[model samples]
Target: MSHYKKRLALLLLLLIGFVLVSCGQPATPQTVEKVVTQVVEKVVTQVVEKEVTQVVEKEVTTIVEVQVEPTAGPFLERARTDGLRVGFVQEKPFGYVDDQGNCTGIDIEVTREAAKRLGINEIICVHLAWEGLIPGLLASRIDVIPVGMAIRPERCEVVQFTDPYQAQGIAALVLKENPKNIHGFQDFVDNPNLKLGASIGASELTIAREQFHIPEDRAIGYSEQVQVIDDIVAGRIDAGMYTAPFVNRYIQEQGPDSALERATPFDSPSYFNTGHGFRKDDPEFVQLWNNTLLEMKRDGTIAKIAGEFGYTDADLLGEDAKVENCCSGDNWQNRACLPK
Candidate 1:
């Protein structure tokens, strides 16, 4: 029996013994009833407090519990609240800050629209050096690079890309007088001493060095496009290079009195396709951009943005403009894979 039950048994035995001892004494039946009633009530109260009440309270406390959030949110969800930081180089038509200090271009507009639709409103534009764009992205200094970086084999090994957005042909820049008589990559080969100037880490520079076999010593790298022009004017380099649209824009902006001119008779068999460049690890986020770009393309939004930058529908990406088709081993920027 329980301790409380044993105590009750002992108390009953004691009460019986007392009753027998007081049999001949003046012990009334009313006094016996009152004593028994008090003993029973005390035992019941002790049992309720010790067994029922304590156990019930403990069970209630355990059952009425809630879970607390222990971890932080996902990166993309956090990005929705935080600003989406975008990286860009000062390349015309694709991305740039104008004389008025307004940041606008095809890539910038495309990024803005895509990010906005994805529920990210604030876009922090980060201007980086042309060569620093990829490294900065790898280092997490910026989020993405939509500055028309060509989706080439070398870049494919370093980072990832979306479907091709636009195509650009390589162009040569020279003095107005055409002193070097440079026309194409072959001209650079003909003059072994002819120093070629292109922005460092540019696909154009890669083409000159890798495709044309222009030796490293002959291929000079500059931090800016303007530096190439400066070195060319100073006669430190025999020729400079850029995309056709970029060189043409520079020529037009400089007017008729400009010292530099686009090297005429320069043409390419293929166009280098470019796209939105981002980190390889974030496949889901990259897919979001690709989906939005598809929407833009279907609704003529991409074409409209292109037109703003002097680009036409012809400049639009071809159906075969994918990463694999655009980049193949050492043969970077496959012309056969892209539109003419």
Candidate 2:
């Protein structure tokens, strides 16, 4: 119990009390700091993600706008200036190059009249083989095929065919004095030894095979029908199957001495119906063609051209002639005459 001892004890006791108070305080501030840091990091990440999503959405919208815009109208306008490049297959009265190298035929006349109506001045005609015409159109070598292309469902998958300009049927051409009682496709099928000549790749050949069951071995395929007619005149072939209008034109062009005479046409409605060909993407050009064809049929321009080419009975609105519903509906039966 000295004064110095009491002072030292008092100081020790104060130090111990200070240590106990520090130990008793809570760690709430550290936990709060950690939570605040995590919250800030989450907010920054969300902002970055939202900005990225906005940029991607904008890019997608711009691409969709570009894709949906119309482009065919401008392309067709440019084509008008350069003259619509047209192709034709030399199939005699329908389309052929004359000795003067001029594209002259029923199809040529029709196309000329259409061009005049459409205000198109230049028409560059390129002569192509019958099989090459479709390929030429796809390759952009030609803008239109103004040949007598028969519209079929098979052809529609590849090219967009305009409204039919003319409708016709399959007929057999024989010597005038021949005593064959052939009237329709059934007659040819019933007769066994009859030698039928047809031009290669011609629609008539397909018709004969599909309808008459004409064997490939019995049918002779020539490069051109003129050669087949020549063979028939020389007694090499029995008969030649071709379009009726074309047969008449050939006979007329060769004069009375030509032994070819068209037989009565077969009754199959699908064997007829012909139209011009175009590219699938050329909707504007096709519309122009369709409008021109309608006008020609109404104004008798088509009839006049048909007469010039020896199509005497060229009826634009015949019972079987359906040219209006070409690319419009699900009516496939009559569409043979109105090919799409």
Candidate 3:
């Protein structure tokens, strides 16, 4: 309450006390008349004082509210001041920490370039498992998802994907010596003894289970790409499924004599592609992301970024993987969406 309000209340109490005192005492007729007139004047004055006090209180509150209210800036501007948060699975050839300990990968670089154009300099990378990406976006734990998460009908219903960054395929990561002679999914199905591994929550794992009918006992799932490869090196499984880009980068890093190799004649779907993810309700950010991606696609910036991580022209998605084509079907054909 304002000071004026407090003073009026005090005066009101004083007037009531004076009225009571006058009534209790035996007063002369002139004195009684004077007391009644004084009481009337005091009541009128108190009522006026209350009105003035209320007006003063309202004005004071308005002034304080105006002074404290914040003025929010644009998202990009705010991000530049703070950092742009980008979420990705904790896997290589997408988003991972390298030997130098910088959070980087093909998808990360692709997003970095796009963000740079949009005037967002710092990339705050949030590493998560495959299942956590969408949930993270939903919970506001992260802002953008730049990873190998392909667009599917069910996923489309929740979050919006950008024009695809690339059309990729699956690779059977195997031993360099080719002792198992495992070329593809057929090898695993043909030989009950052979075990296949894939990253958990990956569509490839689902396809191996549901579509390919690979026996559950023969199929192994790991939480991260690193786990799959580590187990593969340890000979826990005959071969593993990985994104072709990941395989390519792995082969480059590990060299010819490395313990792992891509099992070619690996009859895997080549049309499976992926794009950046955004919340459906955030259309403005989604548009800016899509526009940046389209520009990157047109100017060959995405391709250049991909080459640094072992991605070729064949894997690049220009018009083929636009978000418009994502819902046509879940099959990874020429349109590119299905699991390979």
Candidate 4:
């Protein structure tokens, strides 16, 4: 009994000890490690997905903002801050250098007065050829053309013109000898053999093309109006077409020896109007110039200058003169006129 009881008791004690030891020991490190690794992997995957989505959304939004918004050009600000660079060609009554080499003309004087009102500190006159005025302006070499550029449809596509300050009628400049008996542009139409002369890229060219149906080659463009007058006197051209007042002034200044006479006469409301030319980017400057021109016309300042050039109030803009009618769109002639 004693031996059997001792063996059984020993076995039971060994079994209980094994069970207690097994319960006291911690679980396998690999099991806990695997659970922690699974949790960490899930959190990492969620974070990576969130980050990728956020970055993609941010990039798309940035791209759209960059594409849609366009900033303004810096031209107007620079012009006002650094003063202005005005351009012109030597043309009587509009722009010319005086005997002293200082720039002086009706348009030049008007522009100077307008610049004074614009709070500009300085004005630099740049003398360029007529054909180069617009190209220079577009290239940023010049800020404006104060040569009294007539507002026309094709030019309006490239540049912005201030409200017209003056208006004038069309006429033909012919020799006093009356060789061809040409009185008007209509005469050129009647006699298709005669070639008419005008400055290149001028409203006269348009008139010859649209109204008279004259071909481009027959228009006979010269670089300058003086050249046309010279050619007319030499009989290279039968007649030269230009503004009536311009021809009159040329005859007056040339004296009786010029042998040039202004024959046909025309006036408003069938006239061409001119204003200062500016780059299309600098609209604010054009607005200020137009406002200043209006003030000059109202204050008799324009009249004083006009008298110097033999222009009267009739040449000056009427109070009701509208820029839209001048050359806003397709308003080249009767198409643009407002109802009386």
Consecutive 10-residue window with the lowest summed lDDT within model 3? 331-340
Predicted candidate 2 versus true structure: per-residue lDDT over 163-182, tens digit per residue: 67566666678878655765
Tens digits of per-residue lDDT, candidate 3, 67-157, equal 5513235666777777778897767688889888899988889888888888888889888778888888876677788888877667888
Question: How well does each candidate superpose onto the true structure, as a TM-score?
Answer: 0.54, 0.59, 0.58, 0.55
Q: Rate the local accuracy (lDDT) of all candidates.
A: 0.75, 0.69, 0.76, 0.71
* Worst lDDT 10-window in candidate 1: 64-73
Which candidate, 1 or 4, has the higher TM-score? 4
| Per-model root-mean-square deviation over C-alphas | 15.6, 15.3, 9.2, 16.5
**Highest-TM-score candidate:** 2
lDDT by residue for model 1 (1-340), tens: 2565556745775674487457864446666556555676677677777887889988887755322212125546756887777899887877899999988877898888878888988778899999899988876667778877878887888787887767777778898878888888888888887988999998878888898889888898889888889888999998888877787577766778988887776755357677788777778878777878877777888888776665645567744566676667544455425433
Sorted by lDDT (best first), the order is: 3, 1, 4, 2
Q: Is candidate 3 or 4 superior in lDDT?
A: 3
lDDT comparing candidate 4 with the true structure:
0.71
lDDT of 4 at 49: 89
Q: Which candidate is the best by lDDT?
A: 3
As a whole number from 0 to 100, the lDDT of residue 67 in candidate 4 is 52
